[model samples]
Target: MMVLDGEELDQLYVDPSWQSRGIGNRLVDLAKTQSPTGLALWTFQVNAPAQRFYERHGFVAVEHTDGSRNEEREPDIRYEWRRGPVRP
Candidate 1:
């Protein structure tokens, strides 16, 4: 995970073999402690499971990219989480 300017969550990834084991949750929890006001991250559009995970953690989809701005040239989605009541 990469937190930029002590705010944005720039990157987050866990190996497939290490997923479903709570590491991500722990990391996010730590991130919250570091930046409780909010956090943001970008994930590939193809990663549906990641989207679900972030949503479960109170993050909401906020924006999308069309593969034109990343090194991997893949479409992506940006998610954000705020320190307050959850959104439905």
Candidate 2:
């Protein structure tokens, strides 16, 4: 039940022990139904694994957003998915 910007999915975590069991995929699928077009999320620029997962789920890198907040910040990447069509 976590949400962001009233239109995004954030911090979707499956227990480390449950990793790779397709639980995360299922949750993402569920979230898609509730989202407009589809979901969007941000992950650390270094998290290649997560970026791959999102790509498998049909997300594409739209841009990179500021990771700054009063000095405690890190680079983050923004990804988005469209349940409809992808514009070129």
Q: What is the C-alpha lDDT of each candidate?
A: 0.86, 0.79
Model 1 Cα displacement at 62 (Å)?
Answer: 0.7
**Which digits, one per residue and each the tens of the lDDT, describe model 1 over residues 1-88?**
4354576887677787998899899888888889989998889999999899999998999999998999999999989888997589
Q: List the residue pairs that clash in candidate 1.
A: none
Kindly list the per-residue Cα lDDT of model 2 for residues 1-88, writing each as its tens digit: 3354545887688888988888988878878877867678888888899899999998999988577841448778899888876579
TM-score of each candidate structure, all chains considered together: 0.84, 0.80
Model 2, stretches more than 4 Å misplaced? 1-6, 69-72, 85-88
> In lDDT terms, how accurate is model 2?
0.79
Kindly report which residue stretches of model 1 are placed more than 4 angstroms away from their true locations once superposed.
Answer: 1-5, 85-88
User: Weakest 10 consecutive residues, lDDT, candidate 2?
Assistant: 1-10
